[model samples]
Target: MKKPLVIAATLAVVLSLGLAACGGDDSSEETLSNSELIAQADQICTDYNEQLDTMNEEAALDENSSRQEIATYISDDLVPLYQEQVDELRSLNPNEEDAAAYNDIVDTLESELQVVEDDPEAAIDAEDP
Candidate 1:
């Protein structure tokens, strides 16, 4: 079965990914304004979504594809992509006004990704997934 877990996890990840629109670190010598931070985050989100869409196209799972195949796609493809997106977002410096919110978003995403990683099968079989 294609399974609801895959669909549900995908939805959760997409929603959480969108919230990754602001973050901060001390990497840059110059601080970015809130607007600039938002713009950069937006670009990151756009890039992530584009990449996800491309991966989905490339995966092209059929009805005959096994559950393990779907789970592997999530673990091998989705997880790494999400981790990269999170890392990119974390590298950006959000203004003080947006710092807390940005951290919360990243934290939530990390936790969600953990759940998906801990048990790909369970995630695929989640009742509410």
Candidate 2:
């Protein structure tokens, strides 16, 4: 298996699936412009990346770490973090025209994340045929 730290990097890549950003106050129904949507999504992505960087440093896993250890880190630590990002993206209020496409992206992301969360071992198994 690869070093556990590499898992963090890979997770970052996977989690960065494009965000379809729409903006509104939590309690209000407001429509955001295209630029506003992009901006909100960009901010969320930025925050997610920063959080991942911190997590990677904190993990401090050496090359000798076991596959189980890596998998556990992914399941226990990384999965929840990425899940939060997905949830935040989902919360965005896309316009009616964009809503279907936005939902499709979110659904795809959730499915992909579920695959890793269900069997993190498969993630570390680079040698799998």
Candidate 3:
């Protein structure tokens, strides 16, 4: 009887551990702690800086490759990244201003990206340089 009880206890422990693992890190844009969401917002700012650098360097390259690469980078990387970040940021509490700023960044950047994609020459002409 003692052996059976010990085995059951061990099984319960193992099951609990497995469940904990399955819960995973629920810290995306929509499900995160406050500090974690703030950290994620800061990370998105960093990513924006990186993308700016990439865009500047790409613009100077004078090749179709640069624009193509940037398009892929924007769609494959930046879009999803900021989307997730904004969702995560919105999940934060008592940070309405910061969340609004994050959402605005996401919207503005996405809109600009669509325009650039659809009308590269017009977008370039309209840009500040």
Prediction-by-prediction clash tally: 0, 0, 2
lDDT of 1 by residue, 1-129 (tens): 544335544645544554545534445866667777777777777777788777777888766768888888878877788888778877877777787787778777777777777776666665543
Tens digit per residue, CA lDDT, model 3, 1-129: 122223222222322221211111234445444455455555544554465456445544333444444444444444454444345433443244344544454455455445544543332224222
Q: Which of the predicted structures, 2 or 3, would earn the higher TM-score when compared with the native?
A: 2
lDDT, model 3: 0.40
Ranking by TM-score: 2, 1, 3
lDDT of 3 at 117: 45
lDDT tens per residue, model 2, 3-109: 76666666666655556344311213765555665677668778888888888789876778877778888899888988998888777776676667666777877
- Candidates in order, TM-scores: namely 0.78, 0.84, 0.37
Question: What is residue 37's positional error in candidate 1, in angstroms?
Answer: 1.8
**Candidate closest to the true structure, highest TM-score:** 2
Name model 3 segments beyond 4 Å from true: 1-39, 51-105
Clashing pairs in 2: none
List the candidate 2 regions with Cα displacement exceeding 4 Å: 20-27, 126-129
How high a TM-score does candidate 3 get? 0.37
Candidate 1 weakest lDDT stretch, 10 residues: 2-11
- Residue 22 CA error for candidate 1 (Å)? 4.1
Clashing pairs in 1: none
